[model samples]
Target chain A: MIDLQEMILEKDRLIPLLRKLKKESRLIAPVTNKHGDTLLSEINNIDRDTIDLDRQPQNSLKSFFLPQQEILAHYSVDTTGYNFTAPEAAKETIYFGVRSCDLTALLYMDLIFSKPAKDASYYDRRNRSVIITLGCNDPFANCFCEATNSGPYLDYGYDLQFIDLGSSYYVAAGRRKGADLLNKWDYFFRTVEEEDQKIRYQLFLEARGRFNRNIQVSHACHKLQEEEVAETIWEKLAGRCYDCGGCAYVCPTCTCFSVDDMAIDDSHGTRIRSWDACTSSGFTRMAGNHNPTDRTRHALKQRFLHKLKYDYQKHGKASCTGCGRCVDICFGGVDITTFIEMFTRDAS
Target chain B: MNTNFIPATAVIREIIRENDTISTFRLELINKRVPFSFRSGQFCMLSVPHCGEAAISISSAPNALPLFDLSIRNAGELTNAMHQMKAGEQVGIRGPFGTPFPMADFANSDMLFVAGGIGLAPLKSVIDHCLFQSGLEADAVANITLLYGSRSPSEVAFTTAISSWKEQGIDCRLTVDAGDDSWHANVGLVTELLQKELITKNTKSLICGPPVMIRFVIARLTEMGCASHDIFTTLERHMKCGMGTCGHCHLDGKLVCVDGPVFSLEQLQTMDVMELGT
Candidate 1:
């Protein structure tokens, strides 16, 4: 049998293939809503609604696994005694048209939740889902995933990676699930011709040259380890921060969260966890109104350092995936790229 | 999503009101699977009914388990709900997490514990453990000294524990910020009491309390020729998940949940620690 590791799917057959896949499992893809913003959402009507993979989806795939807010457990203090039941198991899902940077961020989330012990809720959703990444053929204006080693095209980490080649698509399978899909649906794919490999390589080279920003990500990571950022630099960033929390919320790798119990009534409650940002005033505030970190000057200090220095030391790579969403979201021009530029700039 | 945050059930065996605002909850794990054993500085996420969890240190010695004590101050929502909790009621527990104090290194060393307010709860664990080991082990602590402080005489907690430690031939010095009519002990900062103590080469100073108290006491100890490596302390921070996922306890490059709640002064040397003001 021929090894079908890579194949070509005609652009005309993409919709028909997705329709077949949607019948068995829940299908999620990028869709432009009524407000004209494209987000990765579930397709209720595969035939009617147009799937929009042309734009950079403003949101990442973080919420699907580690949701913005989720119920961790349900508890009750009744006559039967206090007890808790873990949330139910997750349904099998097929995530199509996922950007390469977002899938990379999900992989980072997998590592964070696994250590100490695997977070039960996050893994339930993550393990049951299949990831099909849509590699960027043309990097966006703010995109710098090249520096972060995540995208405009990735070498690995996707179950299936699909690259656009004008009239058709070049699909490469990296994992077992992806390889299984190609064998199951062999009718929709063609054997890789010699011309397909040449075109894929040609497009990959063009995508690398298209990145507009050359962020010194590794330089900043190394510089932070050797020397401290000036106090004046911290003050400059913190001064512009309005505490909107948009940067952390938009960040795919900003996996920090807060756990609390929400009461339904007197005896019943649910323990929940919600996404929390280090930039907020209340992130580190303890009981008795005792806040250790002075937010006036040190608000953005821990966040940048944790992303650049701490995670780099632990994981051998910085956590900032350079999706450039934070670069676009921050109105104050105080995104991580700004910090890296300022910190790595040579000072005589 | 019955997730991992589900805490095992615990029954409140007793509640001793330490002061107007502080109480010691004596708890026993009612769950069968939780093989609970912890070191002195490790903390547990205490969950009360209708209220969320809070990271509180385990106060009693491990020899006291399966019964342990969680000394709390009525400073916030969860702790206030905890103060209203009755004995025989049930609460939830998540941990026995964090890097515990270096008990292996404590053998044959002179142990000096300095505490303030509710901070004495964690140090009491190490102190009582040392006392218990003296009954069985040959290389037990050489001696134990306690310098505890409170805001006022009425605000003083752990009076019964202090009396017991004093009766057992341990040197326990009590200090208060303000003097009352019946107050006759040292009426100054806890640092003043530390001033009279002799710091030798083998003394291991373990400190816990408010941030300001820790700063001043460490300064005094360092001036008295105590090496930074020989001095150890546990740092407190806002905590959520006890398993290092939550970002509340981020200190410098370390997560207090993982890297430490307990660290030597040398380990904290160049780190930006809130407790030591480094």
Candidate 2:
């Protein structure tokens, strides 16, 4: 077995460490509000209790890599001539206190942007940043990460995993970057004992048992490829689908986008590239009366199959990380866990 | 710093009016600092100030002159403004983006070209390259056949050039959906021209047209013994960016702007065909 070590962070010291990390790079962490919910926001001042790593954020981690709106190119047109210019690259950022499920979602996104035809824009951001995951002590009711091969603990993607052990937190380095970070702040952490490591693993196991929901689909991509599921099933499930595209909007793995042209001046225009979801009616509409996926049922089916099947066939893993943000955000009560269960059960 | 973007200026050299509805513009780089090389059947994002931007395929062969050709149909706002542009006008051009037609994969196999209306624009690039290379070395290319169909005889693009190719003993066939008194050619849907005997064995095909026409032609080709992998088609999606960043051109997980505007039927099958929310 690999020798494991932990760096303890007392509740009082958490804020100081965050403030120190902020000095070097931008630190984004979860903050709660009067609504009793939390959101990931850039932290200028760190209050340890304000950071809630228990629940997944309402929005996806995708906005960190692929923003909702980005200026792609700027153009200037005049009596003299027209000039075109491309957009600038992103800055260095450290996404702190990210949930394990969201970090797994980032792994799927890496597949989309790191394929043979790599996306330079995504590569720029991915290369410039470090992922700091916080292990979930209390998973939400909607979460089913265990069913999808993800859990409360960090697997391969995260640079660091912070496991809360009551009075103090145990920090485990998952990557060289994490080790280097720990090395920089060696004074802040005392050497961990053998007993502390055992307790951390037990706490993680207890947290995993807390998750109530589970996905039933086994080998999700292969089931989708079989073509056994008919149109009626998709239509039936889609009856409740609102076509809001909230699922995709909140999914870290959904990489659909749309290009926009903004007029900067009479002689020039700025072309903006932004995220777009396939769940919208206008997603596949062409100029003269051609829409390959014109029906809502078809679009809904496409979203799920793309996440569970098409992406897997191309990237070797399911795009979904069972983050369950889609489940909680959907107004129509369209839960992917239920869908997977019904589809896989019927197939079996 | 501005990263992940390249801006290039192109000057309009020539414009060919293909009917009252559509026209093709030829553009050459003004900077001339970098040599722009693009495969046939690849598209670029063409931008006009204030009006908008559209994804247009480079209809000129790389082996040809430095100029690139963009065929515009006066169907949308950008094309409407583009139709009024003069030869000296300048436009913004980005990319030669997306995967090009598999020319190397089809080498040594007999080739068939079927195009309809403005769809002929993309196919023209591949045809030009084949013809140019074949003229230099006849044995290097397979037997080339062109079947071009348009709404009417007056709408046929490259009429003069096509006729010249025909005079040079290139197997060029023309058809019209409806013909006039002046028209002396076959009148029918393009699919009707795809009689089984017309398709040679061990042949590859390139098709581009209206979605319905493409679907019908593909069905006919499959019936006539052409494998899905042997046939290539160019798809036009609502693309805002020529790069894969925009989600507008996505069919399932595949972004048409990046993963393809050119896809064999086999690749397209992996996408979910149902409409959203059923």
Task: Give the candidate number with the greatest TM-score.
Answer: 1
* Tens-digit lDDT track of model 2 for B173-269: 8899999998998999988888776677768888988877778888888888888788888888887666665557767667787888898877765
lDDT of 2 by residue, A1-348 (tens): 333445877767777777888888878888775587788877756754377666667775788887887776677777767776656777778888888888888887786566445676777788888788888888887887776777678766777788888878888887777777888887778778788788898998898889887566455567877755666767776888877888888887888777667786566677666777878888767666467665655657777777777666766667777788887788877657656766777744
Write down the worst ten-residue block by lDDT for model 1 chain B. B193-202
lDDT of 1 by residue, B33-62 (tens): 658888889999998887889999999999
lDDT score, candidate 1, position A163: 94
TM-score of each: 0.98, 0.90
Which fraction of the native contacts appears in each prediction? 0.81, 0.56
User: What fraction of the true interface contacts does model 2 reproduce?
Assistant: 0.56
Deviating ranges (above 4 Å) for candidate 2: A1-5, A34-36, A47-49, A86-91, A115-121, B31-34, B104-110, B222-230, B241-247, B251-259, B263-278
Q: Assess candidate 2 and give its lDDT.
A: 0.76
lDDT score, candidate 1, position A315? 93
Q: List the residue pairs that clash in candidate 1.
A: A86-B2, A87-B1, A87-B2
